[model samples]
Target chain A: MTKTTSDITKRTSIGAQRNPASEEAILTAAGALLSEGGLAAFSIEAVARRAKAGKPTIYRWWPSKAALLLDVYHRQKGETFYADTGNTRVDLIAFLESLLGFWKKNGGEVFRSVIAEAQSDPAALEALRDYAVTRCRASGIILERGVTRGEIRADLDIPLVMELFSSFCWQRLLTGRLDASRAQLAHLVDAVLTGFASKESHAQ
Target chain B: MTKTTSDITKRTSIGAQRNPASEEAILTAAGALLSEGGLAAFSIEAVARRAKAGKPTIYRWWPSKAALLLDVYHRQKGETFYADTGNTRVDLIAFLESLLGFWKKNGGEVFRSVIAEAQSDPAALEALRDYAVTRCRASGIILERGVTRGEIRADLDIPLVMELFSSFCWQRLLTGRLDASRAQLAHLVDAVLTGFASKESHAQ
Candidate 1:
């Protein structure tokens, strides 16, 4: 009986079972304000008012406006890589497809505002940088696995490959000239794959 | 005598001769402000005060802040290219080297600020988009020439290729993870070239 009581106490203390409702509400209100009025509309007082929560509660979790904005960026623009397609080509295609889908569907406004805020705000800039490095590592893992399987060149730099893929998506996002036609995506996937394969195979 | 008189009239009326001293003063003042204070310091009134010129004089030539900023971006960024180096390998190397150099030396702050401002300001965003598309065309030309010369795949999407190239630089810039290391730049160029080259050639 004593052990059981202590176990329950530890689990609750960890806060894994804490209410997610307030957090969700705050994020939703913040997202609304960001899209409607850019970063200027996102003040601590306003967020608390919108979420029907106390200012102290909001401050208890997030240290600054930039931290809260970073949390929102993570929720909106986060990438989860699934590269177990067995074939490297299939895996790479899947990755690019999911990535492009996110870029097309959900990333427009959030990414735009984040980019804007990151320039003047040092904290936002750090968040953006940390996100990039993490994403690069995710892609690098897949490329490295491909190398082990002899699908990609042994001497290839996985980090750079990841950068090239990221560079394409980010360029379009920032410049507002993204064309997501099937043929274009296909061409990009094929060209990138071709370049990663060995030279002798290229001549054939 | 009539021809000479006509030429003189055309030159004087068009104001074809730029006042070197004024241009120098404006560029110098603009550079200092941009480097020191980011985009907020680049207003017409601010520039006029710094350059000791009237706001009307600044407005007379630049039309708006975007155009003025663009002129500054051009001077600082210098030039980026993906020229045909007779071989795909050399051309790609030169392209990456020049781009990395530009990003590190001149584009770090101004481009970052420009991109962030583009997100919030519609007009600035449009200008950035236009500049990106036009400049990217230079890289496209190199890739297209490679295809024509049987060095690269002919079925490439030029726009996507340009995006891929820019994404790397912009991501690093936004994130402030730009390490201007020779090995890193070289690796990026190599990986991208291979990724975009013909499949048969890559197999070798």
Candidate 2:
């Protein structure tokens, strides 16, 4: 029987040492293609052509397209800004503003594509969940700082609170509301920080 | 030039009065297809074939696959439960429980598909946004009741608060976390109702 493309790919990739330069080229090309055409125009064949890398080589390094997409996203997201303003509300708002700004610039499309991919691929979903957990833990430092500073309650659920904040951001990004004003962000922070119950209700 | 399928469909659909029976059949078939196979297997062609209706009939009425999908979602979501326990926290929790239960039952798959569709189609995005606004308004009644009963602050941002609640639910649903326990739901409600700030900070 003739060797199929998968057979050839597996044969070629076996014991082949990964080249860092090729990986960088592949990632850069993937990012540019995604930015230029969005997810609909993204494909491994396209990435191979753009990066001058062989298709089997791309597949050998990245197990799946979702894996490659996730790497590109991580590469694009160089560093997350964590603001500590000596106040929970201010710190949270500043952090969100910085995050949203990054999203509006380029992160939104890439992250949105990841989320959309998750809807159809279980591996993508797993990757997204793992990434979200890591980011939440990193961002939870703000709330932890608030706790240490005596601004927030010590017993507060950090994971849940961070989930709330991330959910708000995700909704905005997915719905194309990345331009949320500072006032709106302030309102969201206030709602989380101060609650909405009347003073009378709290007293009761 | 030979008459194309589009021409035939357009010619056949123009001035053709809608049959409620056929409409019901189409909606029913679309819902069934989605339930069995999810979005990957969903299409107007499959819907038309399943409904025993011509493609033109389906296209003539629904206009687009997104329109038909939205209709199926609406039809599947018969009525939303609005709980009023005379307490904002209890009412919100109960309402969310009802909504989540409905989502877990069947609405989750349908709604997830719609959200996935919105990611690629601008029309679907618009439809999703319009539907969200309408649903938010409908659900805002619970918060409004709280305002009337003096449980919540009169100046509270109803739309914003409802948005937070919806965003939380959407995140959970999208991330396959619809199985949130009652205790977790209570925690969310408490976080929204009591805030996370320490009493001393509030006093200061």
Candidate 3:
């Protein structure tokens, strides 16, 4: 059984009544189905069947297929481990490497599902944008630290920079290219950051 | 009635058999259908019915929906005009502004369909990637000209730069965000080119 986004909100007030274990089971099952079957085979019914939960249980946690998948995507992402080494370039590269690794290993399929769904469904696009917003803010920590340490310009637009960074990753994945080599990733971060650090940008 | 990739190749050898007007009508119908209803409403059947051509007429030229849609995308892009001012900065801003405008008005819907279809189907991905490759090269001209004029770094990686630039556009489109303003586009181009130009990058 899965808990809907709102259900989780409600359950937060009283954790004793709802079993948290079912949420894990449901998400795990959804991930398995996605891994083996792709988006075409994933559905609320299929997830419920695989998890031995009623369809209502899945519905309670997510209102639609995209919703369920979004939860799965976030859950999977929450587990990818990376750290700040107190160096902007070093930290950014490590962060992107972890991200690219995760995408190659897991996030690619899930993101593909979300992006594909977003193409036609406005709701899915909103959810994806919401997710992107969170990740962008989180990733901005690298630049934030960089600015504080004087490794990055104080006036750099963090949001636009992050958008550019993610755009590269998503574009490559959507195009079915291999995960970029560390060298390529290094080039990207260096290029964007260099541009930010330059006097020409500051003059504007 | 639009020509297939192979058909175009064969046509180069034998140029007399094709009717340019029907080809134009089929492509125009496809662009309109994609504009009005997106991928769901775009089909060999719908296109044939709309163009008053037989299904075989479409298949004879396109072979598949992805191919047909690719042609439509290319046709749309071919019509967007932008100048290559001798100044790299000016030319890039103009180019990106044109792209952003195109995506906002028309390319967004069509690109969303192609990107969405590519996510699910390998063949569609190949077609979309082919389009991307061509566009990437074409856009690379800005950087190439910059290098020639001693404005951009001579040793910069063109392919990586193109990936970054396209990533920004596709990312915005996929996330359902408005195109970055021209000032923002200029900022991005300037930032990226600055990064490429900075001596630190060359030291690597």
After superposition, candidate 2 runs with Cα above 4 Å error: A1-63, B1-63
Cα lDDT tens digits for candidate 2, B126-168: 6676666556566677877888888887776676668877887
Candidate achieving higher lDDT, 2 or 3: 2
Which of the two, 1 or 3, has more TM-score? Answer: 3
Give the Å shift of residue B127 in candidate 1.
0.3
Clashes of each: 22, 0, 5
Candidate 2 is graded, for docking, as medium
Better of 1 and 3 by DockQ: 3
TM-score for all models, in order of appearance: 0.70, 0.78, 0.76
Docking class of 1: acceptable
**Candidate order by DockQ, highest to lowest?**
2, 3, 1
Per-model DockQ: 0.35, 0.52, 0.39
The ten-residue window of minimal lDDT in model 1 chain A covers: A8-17
For candidate 1, lDDT tens digit of each residue in A82-156?
Answer: 558766766766776767667677666676677678887886776566556556655666666677677777667
Q: Per-residue lDDT for B1-204 in model 3, tens only?
A: 123335322213211244678888888888888778877799989999888888877777665688788788767777344377788778777877777778898777778888998988887887777667656655666777667766666556665777777777788888877657777887776666665222433344
**Candidate 1 residue lDDT tens string, B1-204:** 113323321212211344779877887888788888877777888888999988777766565576568767767765446565677666766766677677777677777777887877877777677667656654566666667677666556665676676677677778776665767776766666666333343455
